[model samples]
Target chain A: SQQGEEDPQALSIQEGENATMNCSYKTSINNLQWYRQNSGRGLVHLILIRSNEREKHSGRLRVTLDTSKKSSSLLITASRAADTASYFCATVGFYNQGGKLIFGQGTELSVKP
Target chain B: EPEVTQTPSHQVTQMGQEVILRCVPISNHLYFYWYRQILGQKVEFLVSFYNNEISEKSEIFDDQFSVERPDGSNFTLKIRSTKLEDSAMYFCASSEMGGSSNQPQHFGDGTRLSIL
Candidate 1:
């Protein structure tokens, strides 16, 4: 089974709008993390929420994890054109070796000026 | 800020040849990892190393693939015999610690491997 899967494969928004991306996983996890990637670049860590934590915020980014539902959401507020990139949710769990991550396919977000 | 560094932004290799990708993780990091992503695909874990040995590896890390920390500063992934499917952007990452510590990983830009 795929460990992580993201929805709304693509999103287009104007600058200043909020962008929300959802991700679901197949099993229990120790922690869930969000990452962003610009075209052809490596991933940049955004935020992480442990199974015990419900929500976390970093600057303009917010992340919420629902263990019961095995789902998570990432919200980018007041987005800018520079924020255009792909966002992914990854998990660490029994299926994943310690420190190893299982990643979602990612949602491509485009913020137009 | 310190960053993980990967060598050769891009590499082209003939199928059946061996290839080695190198990374220099952050100086204080205790855990090291390698991951790959084919074009437009999710990043997949390849293996994780700590204390100079592999602690965990995915199925994709078969006999053909091996990792080593030859020195205090360098970590490497070597594919004995590359295949067309081996082509992908390989990234190296590291963190101060692992598990419940909730340490987010830092990554290198990536090394794009193209197999011919």
Candidate 2:
């Protein structure tokens, strides 16, 4: 069964606007990672935020984790047409070995040019 | 940059047929995994392998599904008897470290399996 659930099943925005997606998980995790998938393509690793940490950033992407709420958020600073894709949040439980990841129902984002 | 690689971008097979999907993870990675995404459904974890053993697996990974690291560099997933409901996109992934570490898993372009 899926342990994480992402909010806003789909989002549509114009270029240059900021986009934010939230994910909530059911269990304690060692870390949470975000990934992006282009249409009909593989998932790309975006960023990871450990349970001990609250926020992390990479290029235009920002991820924040709140263990108290068992939720995380991904923020795209300035959206572009190329930024359109499905975003997923996966959790690695503290006891899970070999990097098994439980993924969430992804949020599909569309950036209009 | 190195990435995980999967073979036969797409495969079509009839029910009850056996199928094997192959993958070559990043050269230096030690952990490997298989996941499947049914159309319009969330991605689901199947199994994880490390040190030539099954480290973990989900309930979705039943007796019909098996994973193997037959060679030093190749990992494979096999279905003994495919079912029509098994049609989905199968993904291969690898990570340098285990769940205890903070490293992220890298995924390969999935194989679209079509069961008839």
Candidate 3:
């Protein structure tokens, strides 16, 4: 079973607008990370928020995590046409063996000019 | 600026035939992983290798899938028998922290495998 799952499988927005994508996971995790994929290409790491951290920011990306809710959200501000891509949330479970990322069904975002 | 690199950007094979997807992770990275994304589906974890052995694998990684770090720089994923359903973009990733909670894994461009 997948540990992380995203909501609103697809999202559409206009350039300069803000887009929010949500994710919910089933297990306790050490961190939650977001990734971006352009078309069928490999994933690009976006941001990672640790369990001890509630939020983080990088450029136009903002990510928030709530361990008690087992949920996280990715917000892209001032979206651009180039921001069009699929977004995925992955969970890094809290374990010593090695943290494995279980990916969620990605949300495809299309930014129209 | 270092990034993961995958060979043979695209590969086509007949069903029941064998195929190997290769990758070279970032230098100085200790952890490696393979994930696949079928058309119109979420990316799925196939396996993770560390210390020259598989530390974890998903259910989707069954008897057909195998991973190897043949040398110091190369990591390979092999499917013994190609199946049409196995067609997907396979991505190789590496991280410096060995899956520590604080680091993010870097990914390769991916190898598109088309099983005929």
Q: Pick the candidate with the highest DockQ.
A: 2
List the lowest-lDDT window of 10 residues for candidate 2 chain B: B51-60
What residue pairs clash in candidate 1, if any at all? none
Cα error, candidate 1, residue B47 (Å): 0.4
Per-model TM-score versus the true fold: 0.97, 0.98, 0.96
Ranking by lDDT: 2, 1, 3
Which candidate gets the maximum TM-score versus the true structure?
Answer: 2
Q: Model 2: per-residue lDDT, tens digit, B4-116?
A: 99998999999999999999999999999999999998888899988999998888899999999988999999999999999999999999989998899999999999999
User: Which docking band does candidate 1 fall into?
Assistant: medium
Whole-structure CA lDDT of model 3: 0.90
Model 2 whole-model lDDT (C-alpha atoms): 0.93
Q: Who is ahead in DockQ, 2 or 3? A: 2
lDDT of 3 by residue, B1-116 (tens): 99999998999999999999999999998899999989888788889898999999989899999999999999999999999999999999998876564789999999999988
Which candidate model has the greater DockQ, 1 or 2? 2
- In candidate 2, stretches whose alpha carbon ends up further than 4 angstroms from where it belongs are none
A37-103 in candidate 3: lDDT tens per residue? 9986789999999988999999999999999999999999999999999999998877735667889
* Model 1: interface root-mean-square deviation in Å: 1.8
* lDDT, candidate 2, A1-113, per-residue tens: 43767998999999999999999999889999999999899999999999899999999999999999999999998899999999999999877767788899999999999
